[model samples]
Structure formats: C-alpha cells, structure tokens
Target: MPEATWTYLMDMDGVLVHEEHLIPGADELLAELTGTGTPFLVLTNNSIYTPRDLRARLLRTGLDVPEESIWTSALATAKFLDDQRPGGSAFVIGEAGLTTALHEVGYILTDRDPDYVVLGETRTYSFTSITRAIRLIEQGARFIATNPDATGPSREGSLPATGSVAALIQQASGHAPYFVGKPNPLMMRSALNRLGAHSETTLMIGDRMDTDVRSGLEAGLKTILVMTGISAADTAEHFPYRPSRVIDSVAALVGSTDKPFG
Candidate 1:
C-alpha cells in the first residue's frame, strides 16, 4: 500500500467495524494507515463509551489502535460545553457515560438551576427525564446534543440511536441543540488539533453523509464516503451534500486511492 496524499480521518462503526466485529479488510486498511503514519483517528458518534474503553474494544478486535486515535462525541460534548459555557452547570438527560465524561472534564452536572441541558442516547430515557429536560430548556437553559444519528443498525436490527433522542429534545424544547458528533466542526477540529494538521492536508473517510461528509466539509477537509454502514449506492443521489470522494469501502483507500469518484 502506498501512502495517501493527505492525512485520513476514519470513522469507526461503519467504515471500520460493525458491533463487536471488524468489517472485512478493516485491519489491513488500518494497519496500512498506521504503518504509513497517515494520521487517522477513529471518529465515532457513539458516546456510550469513553476513549479508553474504545481503545480497549479495538484492541480486542485485533486492531492495535492507540488511545489518542479514539475520539468520541462524549469527549467532544464536554469540550464544547467547556468552551462555550465556561464552567457552566448542566442537567444531563443522558446516561452515566455522558455525565461521567462531563464530570471528568470539571464541568458541574447538577439538577438545580442548570444553565444548560445535555441530551444523548440513554436507555434510561423516560417520560420523567424528558419532562425535566423540557422544563429546563423552557426556563432559558441552553440545549446540547451529542450526535444526531437517527438509527444505528446492529446484529439485532435497526435500533433507536442518538439522533432520535436529539430530535425528541428539539421537538419538546422548541429549540434545536448544537450537535458535537461527526459533521459538526468540533469533532474535526479536535482531531486536527491532535494530529497537528490543517483541513487542506486532511481527508475524512466514513459511511454517513450527514455526519462524516458534512463534518469534513465544514472543517474544509476532503471527504470520502464509504458504503459499509448507513449510506448506500441508491441514497447517494438523495443527499443535498456529497463527499469529495465516495468509495465502496475503506479497502479502496488502503492499497491505492486509484478509483475515480462517482
């Protein structure tokens, strides 16, 4: 495999792996990138796990990814709040994963007089929890969402994802949240900062247009959409926004980026 023209930002779930299994050829693609110092990170919208946890998961899958390569919406959410709100208190309508990450970053998470409301894909979401979130937002509390992915398919089938919860919060609060996952510049900026590269020199590869392509485009990086998870051949034409390059899978970018863009 030859070195790519620019640094690559890789998406997890779809572009690399599927649940607890690695997608076919993912290891070879990732290994080629690492050997060439392609400068890629596992950008994931799933915030259920921390970066440390993600690192371990990848290792278990036989992909020796470093901790720094795993960047989740959980970390991005904390960074966004810390920058925008600056020591502000938040009422998290999310699971322990979100609140724990927020607390680790020195943000105050409290139920009383919270300046903002944070929402994510929480299995614990109930009427009482949602009602409290709406009440906070109604009282001038700002709203923040981790990701906006509507459905994530697993071995079981398609299931409600982070985007569903984000939609619910927006509908009830009558105010859309500032997203922090892929497609939202925050995730790209964080990865770029860590990789020490500019958008002109970076290439983001993933399977989702709304998230990966949008995020890369917003960050001024070249986008490559792979057809492994969400986006497919039929849906490509429907997206108002398109990636710079669309490949069948990450394997295309591995040995050679020689294929023509469709």
Candidate 2:
C-alpha cells in the first residue's frame, strides 16, 4: 500500500526557532513541505505579534514561512467568538495580534458594556486595563482568554502570561475565562480545520508534552514530542498519556516526512 500523505501542524518557538535562532533542519523541513505542496501550519500560543510580524521574524532567521501559514491562539480565539456570537463586541486586553484578529472578524473593540472581556498575551499588562476587564466581567460580560500558559520564556527569566492575568481577574470577578489555546483540543481542531486535513492523516510536532502532545492526542492526531524545548528527554513518562512517538528534533524527520512514525 502507498504511504498516506501527511499534513503537519508544528509548534513555533522551541521546535523551529528558540529565542530568535533557527533550529537545525527547520529550514530544510519547511522547504521540503513547500516544495511538495504539503499542507502545514506553524502554530503558536503567543498572542503578542501578528502573523506578518511572526513571518518577518522567522524570515530574519532564514526561514521562509508565509504569513498566512501561521496559526495563533489569538486567531483561534477570534474564530471561536465569531462563531459563537457573530458581530459581537469585546473589550480586549492584548497586543496587535489579538486586536487585529478581532477586527478582521468584525468584532467591535470597546470598553463600554461589551459582550465579552477577552484577555490575550501582552508584554506589559496594565493594572488599569485589567481592572476594567474585571468590572466588565462583573457587569455580566463573558470572560474569554487566548491561552492557559501561566508563564512565558524570557531572556531574563519567566514572565507571567495570559493565564496568570486570567487567574487574577477570575479571583476578583468570580468568573473563570474559557481558554482557547493548546491543551484545550480546540486549538488543534482549529488548525486541522484550517488545513482541511483530517486527524488521521496529520502529524503534530512540538517540543512540549503538556501543550502540543496533549492537544494533538486529544484531537486524534499523531503527536511527536521533540526534545529541543521545555520538556526534557525523560518527561513523557510523568504524563498520564503518551505521544505517538518521540524524537530528538525536527532535524531527524527531515527526509522521513512521508512516513514520520514508520
């Protein structure tokens, strides 16, 4: 029997590039995918930058990913809101990526009696904005967050992310936000939908067992846990579930894209 053609959903930060540096074999794998016209999306939970911004950054590292091929938690959140309540209004606390997505989806960004209080990643979280979000949620607006990642990596150290801010708002307003990013399975499903790919023929490659592998497993896709990111070599045994396979990095799968698991 001929091997099934595989579609790829890949995590960006640790798997492709780490701290602005391209990982070994990243360019080669991407070139192969593009050359063959295989469907793929570069996925990220970070909501700070738009896809154009991310594409430029990747280009700086010599990776030629197209802007439209990047999928973000911000985009997923916007899509969810658009589906749940089309043409709704939201008071969003995020950067360009989040705001741009909401705008594209025709959501009205406002602070006056909005229908939802959306929280996303921002380098600087303002107490004033957070206070306003809490008040809006208290006023009966639903709470929604892009991702549940509590901390983000930084050169200095770990920085508090969207999930941390969501926790604070939940404590003050007694309302927990519905996270739409990885580990939720919603993110994986959304990416699959965007690629027009089915879970059975798709492969999810990531460096984290918690977010990437967990989400892919739940979404019924084959998951590959790479050792180049947050999860250490021995990390998989601690998780209740296991990935479909584990590898050193994307470099190992360069020539084996047709049958990654085999």
Candidate 3:
C-alpha cells in the first residue's frame, strides 16, 4: 500500500513517550502525519486521563498531538457502553478520565444499583471502592474494565493496574470483568471506526507484542513493533504471533512515511 494512503493507530506511552520524555523522532513522525493530512489516533490503554488531559501532557513533552487525535480506553469503554446500553448508570471506580467519558456518553455515575460496575486506571486503588465494586458485582451489576493491563510503568517501578484489581474483584464477586482495551480487538475496531478508517489501510504502531501488536494483528491492521519501550529486541520471538515489522524506534520511519512496506 502507498504510505500516503495508510492511516495510523499508535500506542501512546511506549511508542511515543516514556514517562514525560519524548521518544526520539516521535515528534517528527507526528509532524509528518499531520503535514500529510493522514488520519491517525494516539491510542492509550491508560484510562486515567482523558484525551484533553493527555494532549496537554504530550504537549509538555514537546509532542504537539491534538486532543481529537488522542483515543483512550476510557473513551472506547464509554463508546461501548453507549452502544450496548445508552444512558445507563455505572458505579465507577476511576478518576476524571473514565468519569468524563462516561458522562459524555450520557451514562450516569451512580453507586445505587447501577447497570454496570466500571473500572479504570487510578493512582490510588481504594480499598473501600474495591469492596463496593465487589459487592455491586455480586448484587448483579455487570462488570466492565477499561483495560486488562496488569501493571503500568512508573518512574519508581511497576504499579498494579486495573487488571490486577479486576482480578481481586473477580475473586471476591466470582465474576470476571470484560476488558475493553488493548489486546482486545474491540479496542482496535472501535478506534478504526472512530477514525473512519478501514483496518486494511491502517497501520498500528506500538512497543509491546502482547497488547499492541496482538490487537493490531487481530484487527487486521499492519503492526509495527518498536524497541523504545517495555519490549526488548528478542521479545517478539517469545510471542506466538509477530508484528508485520520490527524497527528500532519511530525514528527509523521518519523519512519513509511515503514508502510502500515490502
């Protein structure tokens, strides 16, 4: 496919930036995409921040991604809920990102016998909230989580993410959550739908084989794995599946945006 015709779905944290530092050539690639008028969305499984918030954060890192160019798991989850049960209420255990998306979707935030118990990323995982979520799930509230990421990266180290807490909730309530983020093709399909792009013509870029590459592959988009984040050079070999291309970083693709992939 001609590169000019290729739309893109890119992972945010590892592929673009790492904890407030811009990956080399990330800005250039985005500039090229924007300059060429290519359709692209910066995707993130982290539901902690809304697109607006993320855009601001990225701008701070010297990456000028527009708010509309960002897509979060929170938004994807909200979209799913809106489609499944419009105007439904959810007992949420998350911050503004998750809450704002749900709100925008006409979903009510409530703890009183809601239609679903929605979970997302939070810096502080409250014991009280988790207990309430468990009880609510046991009381017949359907369980939903923004993402299934077990851990998230931090300057300090790895921190427990939504998936880990979801496991605890499932153990207590005997109900597993339906994860709505990366590694789930639902996330990728929803993104493509949002971008108004076809999977066949879109490219997915990320650093992880487990989530990014896997989801892109499942969604039938060409996947490119970069070495700028969690995955090492040999990480793809351990995976049952492989990315369409593996490069050192987004840096390598700087001038090749218009070149056809072989």
lDDT of each: 0.80, 0.95, 0.93
Candidates 1 and 2: which is better by TM-score? 2
Per-candidate TM vs. native? Answer: 0.88, 0.98, 0.97
Q: lDDT score of model 2?
A: 0.95
Clashing pairs in 3: none
lDDT of 1 by residue, 196-248 (tens): 88888788888878778888999998888888888888666888877887778
What does the lDDT read for residue 109 in candidate 3?
92
- lDDT, residue 250, model 2: 95
Candidate 3: regions farther than 4 A off: 1-4, 260-262
lDDT, model 2, position 28? 97
lDDT of 3: 0.93
In angstroms, how far off is 147's CA in candidate 2? 0.2
Candidate number that wins on lDDT, 1 or 3: 3
Candidate 3 at residue 43, lDDT?
A: 96
